[model samples]
Target: MVASLLSARGLNKQFHSGNQPVSVLSNLSLSLEQGESLALTGRSGSGKSTLISILCGLEQPDSGRLTVLGEAFDGDAGRQTEARWASLRRQQIGVVFQEANLMPALSLLDNVRLRVRLAGQDEDGCRDWLERLGIGELAARYPDQVSGGQRQRAALAMVFAMKPALILADEPTGSLDRHTAEDVTGQLFDLQARYGCGLILATHDIELATRCNHHLDLGHQPEA
Candidate 1:
């Protein structure tokens, strides 16, 4: 059996709006093994983004627990130390977001190779990933210089170059047209399979969710 790469138990999150508390996630539980792909589907404002953030250790839940790649996170100073290992997670974990979120100052190639530079690896190989993703020609271009689909594609290439063990994506194709979205989505799944990384994508796109091996529908659950 493939080893479990990530696990969450009783995952809960809440926020306070003025005098009242708004619950975001309640006892949400999930697990992912190496090379697995899970798609999260839900309506808007259903705590999907909150859950994703918590899973990535970007936000702390009011209560609950999470473990990633065998290490536990408690949201304490010790866990802060552990979370500093987020760099390690970044090195080994790819993240694709709806906006592409590339820096305006860097060229496409420079953006993709930035992680490589940070890890002291050869940046030349970034060219191959760009070529594979069919964004090679755009390498010389800046983020604002490209179309939305192209920018997202460039972002994927950047994360792909990392060869992460797990990938957490939130509506990666949300900004693209249908055809372009499908194109980018196909490339992402292909790379995920090729690299044997766990993929957990949060999206409301049914077509996108259908492409994954497994699906988790957050819309059916009661609001937290």
Candidate 2:
């Protein structure tokens, strides 16, 4: 049988606003296989980001079981150590945020190199990734010197350079213009397919969600 890349069961999360507790995620569960893409679609504040955070080990669910690349975490077992989660993120997961994902101090090439090095990948090919993403000319520029689209391209180069087993992109193109968003999305899907990695993209764009192998709407009823 083909092994799953990621899995979650009975996931539940809640937060407090003043004296009231609001449920963010309730009995949420899903899975992703290698080379498969799952688009998570939901309205804003519908637990999309929260789910991504939990999947990437950035936050713990109040109750659930999550397994990623053979690493398992259950509510009964408590949260994993910060060091452990950090290591997992550094080596196995690549996250692309809407903005501020790049290191402001480093040049674009250096940022990609750093991520590649962290994943035990060769740093020499970092430039190749940028070139593939059509940002080779901006390799030496700082994040602030580039346009939003170029910065996002650099982010993609960094993520792809890391050679992560799984990628979690939360509204990766949310801040870009429609044309720019489409370009970035195309490159993202192409590289994801070429790398044979698992991807979980959280966004409200229905057209974008339809491109993925599967789509899960968090606004709908959670599986029993």
Off by over 4 Å in 2: 76-80
Per-residue accuracy of model 1 over 1-224 as CA lDDT, tens digit each: 79888888887777989989877677777899999999999899878788878777777777777788777775554556555657655666677889997889999999988866765567779989889999898889999999999999998988888777888999999889999999999999999999898999999998788888888887675544
Task: Give me the runs in candidate 1 sitting further than 4 Å from their true place.
Answer: 77-79, 82-85, 222-224
Kindly give the number of clashing pairs for every candidate.
0, 0
What is the alpha-carbon lDDT of model 1 when measured against the actual structure? 0.83
For each candidate, give its TM-score against the true structure.
0.93, 0.96
Model 2, 44-84: lDDT tens digits are 99999999999988888999898888888875433355566
Can you give the lDDT of residue 75 in candidate 1? Answer: 52
Q: Kindly give the stretch of ten consecutive residues in candidate 1 with the minimal lDDT sum.
A: 74-83
Using alpha carbons, what is the TM-score of model 1?
0.93
List the lowest-lDDT window of 10 residues for candidate 2. Answer: 75-84
**lDDT comparing candidate 2 with the true structure:** 0.91
